[model samples]
Target: MNTGRDEDALRWDGDDDPTLDVGTRTAGADPTPDASGHDAASGEDAPPLALPDGFTAVGKDSDTVGHIEADGTVVMPGDKAPLSSPMLITLGILAGVYLLFTIGWIVGGLRLQGTAQFLVSPVGYQVALWLAVAAPALWFVTAYALTRSSKSWVRIVWLLAGLVVLVPWPFIMVGAVGTVAR
Candidate 1:
């Protein structure tokens, strides 16, 4: 649709091609130059990130690397890759542990009103069960958080271990309060 009046080829307003600032609007056609003798507006092309193949560009055409599955599906995952079974398993374990502990507390409290089906110390039994589940879940969470951190694994391990050691103190204190009140 260009009239093709001038000598220099028209440049796109944007690198995306659709919003072109062609012809006289280009930096090449800028009348004023900076101290370096080149137009300051010429550095616009440096923002784009390079990408690999199989990821075909669609509308708006950003320079970001889009993910392309082997089945030819395009997914823009950004900084993260898809989770594997191990990762999903780890997440599931964490969720299960937290849920078990929370539900156990509620159920134990409800059963405290003279239920023959519940244990002598229903809350203790529930706590023990939840602790059993928490061990592996904590291991996975600590290892994951530590491994992903920039700090040394030793430091991360120590920090998480300290937190683990400290976590049960409040529960122990509550138990002591009950014993002392009796």
Candidate 2:
């Protein structure tokens, strides 16, 4: 019975190329010597890798790759930190609120369909209803995009403002059941 595990099937073209042997070195081992005859970890006064123009090295062992300006200032590019846990949670909550607002608008607008038809044409009512339904999402996206370059607090403030301004008033008053809440 053949196990159907052919070794030849797992091999790709250029599999024997030495240049493709990345991450194959053991821990604490020096990297292969470059064409300049210098080992990367040999502690010699030579850079490990040549960086392209306008590009700077970052991450582990990046201090050795720091670029020096003519004025003797060392320029090191740092990685942008990810969003904090609290900010992420806050954004998630805001997104949930916006989603709920959109659902509320949809339900509320549909509930008003009968009354709206009497005041406006069927097409006009439908267009208005859809616009209302999309208002929350549009506001959220716009605020997020516009405030991307601003501080986190500014974004939060804009989102909070939208929450206040885009309240589904029709839904709050008439509700999904279509009964006026005193």
Which candidate tops TM-score?
Answer: 2
* TM-scores for all predictions: 0.29, 0.56
List ranges where model 1 is wrong by over 4 Å.
1-62, 77-80, 107-182
lDDT of 1 by residue, 113-159 (tens): 35422645756755664564465446555656766534344544554
Clashing pairs in 1: 13-20, 13-21
CA shift of 136, model 1, Å: 16
lDDT of 1: 0.48
Q: Which ten residues in a row have the lowest lDDT in candidate 2?
A: 73-82
List ranges where model 2 is wrong by over 4 Å.
1-79, 176-182
State the RMSD for candidate 2: 16.0
Which candidate's lDDT is highest?
2
